[model samples]
Target chain A: MARMLSGRLPDPPAAVRRGPPWAGAFPSTLHDQRVASLLGIALGITFGTCFLTGLVSHFMQHPPNWLSWPSRPVWLYRVTQGLHVTTGLASVPLLLVKLWTVYPRLWERPPVRSVTHALERLTLVPLIAGSIFQLATGIANIAQWYRFHFFFTVTHYWVA
Target chain B: MSGDGDGDTGARADADAPAPAGAGLSVGGFALRVVLVAAGLAALGYGVDGLLTMPRATRPSNAAAWLIGGIVVHDVLLVPATMLAGFTLSRLVRAPYRAVVQGALIVSGAVALMSLPLWRGYGGSVDNPSVNPLPYGRNLAIVLGAVWAGAALLMIGRAVRARRTGPG
Candidate 1:
């Protein structure tokens, strides 16, 4: 009765009482979910294009036994490759800005809240590693930087 | 992640409260989460399998190094450095021109980073005119010049508008 009258809520449960260290590092008006969602949507579209276009390039290179890609469109390969490179390029800023917006939350302590949260976070490990792999390798590939021993195309394909 | 490290002291009323126990997962959402994890693991496993089978071509060891290295390079070097630069630079600009300045920086930074490789011309081949044909360094300069020109106009317009509207 006294606590209710005073309008103070009870403390959070023992397991997850502390707030994340980076909760207030950024301004909400500028770096909230709205901003994150906007960048995420853009990344989704560009990365989707890159994915589909990547398949087209792979097929063109390998010439799959299952399906005969049309030769009628002389410019088909050109178009897909152009879109892939451009969209991949576009993703750099979107990825960077998206990171800029939400990277503050990387400091979350007590990293796992529950079993479900832990599982969800586990999935992100491959995701972040894979995406960054693609981005770095792709740029190196275009520049002929050859930073890795693995054949770029082979690794890039499997990862994607 | 209740990123509200600063506390709930009147920052912005009714912003997202820290997610509660269960993290607000509903039954359907929980099912979806299960599916997502399963699919992610499947895909990742497949990728690893492909890397392993083609030992010579893929070189899984080196590839794994690059994969983890990307995360490190981005998390440790790229993201923090870029964010800190932006944060430090933002303090120097006045309010009315802030958006324009930030926008120009982002645009030019992306353009420059994307185009730098081309300007370096390491990949350009004499036999293949298709690759890096033009003078990319000069071209990049022109693009940046135009970008700053547009930014200047935006800043002037924003300042004029701010002056007319009076202080908010």
Candidate 2:
């Protein structure tokens, strides 16, 4: 049975055996886990601030029947929106460096086929894509470019 | 992968320990996962609802163009420019003052970006006297000047401390 199986099995392709094209391109200095963790926490805080402030602005614009927005502050909207824009802008640099830090892992070959391995890869899709989407929509909305057919407030709020 | 310290060893041991029969997962982990999933679903629902109820006259193509343009302008142009500035600062600034300089640059960049619309008079409206009434260009300049001045003071303070220490 061992001899019969050996004869039927085909050799693995050269590329599959060799691994990814960027397998050897991971930078030695770019693997600082401490920097990555620090930046990740910072980014998370900035994103949370942006999201919360965005919610406030949304509610102010479209208050529900049970909710009443105050007009006494006068500059309330301006401050919150300014904060949202500033935090969103600050996120640009933080996001870039965070991506740079984990970039090497993008090329890492899975050592074993497992559910955990697949889940790890799947989670990255939302992390990267959602970040880009949020930032892009945010900048455009602030610029008041309404290039899309949908309402900017609705899309931005949901995305946030 | 590199086992460097006792903290890592302790963490590994915790991971290897068997889970409790009634509570297999950590509370923090479970809560975080639940919140993340709910947020995702909420966002998806809102997006779908927005799309379905959008005005017929609204043009989606413009929105798509702006979104794509933003990504290109940021990733292709702004990122590289910031990277170049960072590289220049790292090469020119001494180790003792590098962090201060980098901090100043980041603060200035954020302020400048936030001030762009104001500088361009995008938010100025005669209908509302309270909206963007201040002179943004002058305000931005003052803010940036203060940031640099503060950074200079920090550098001086560091130098004084180093001098007092008489060389490590």
Evaluated on chain B only, what are the TM-scores of all the candidate structures, in order? Answer: 0.77, 0.67
lDDT per residue as tens, model 1, A82-127: 9988898889888777766666556554565555444445555566
Q: Return the DockQ of model 2.
A: 0.18
Tell me how far the alpha carbon of residue A92 in candidate 2 is from the true structure, in angstroms, after superposition: 5.9
How far off is model 2, as Cα RMSD? 9.8
In candidate 2, position A59 carries an lDDT of 83
Q: Summarize candidate 2's per-residue lDDT along B1-168 as a digit string, tens digits.
A: 011021122222222223311133466754554455455445544543554466443234554454456556655776558667867887899989988998898788766765566666664357676766788788888999999999999999999998999897
Q: Model 1 has how many clashing residue pairs?
A: 3
TM-score of chain A of 2: 0.76
Backbone clashes in each candidate structure, one number apiece?
A: 3, 4
The 10-residue segment with the lowest total lDDT in model 2 chain B: B1-10
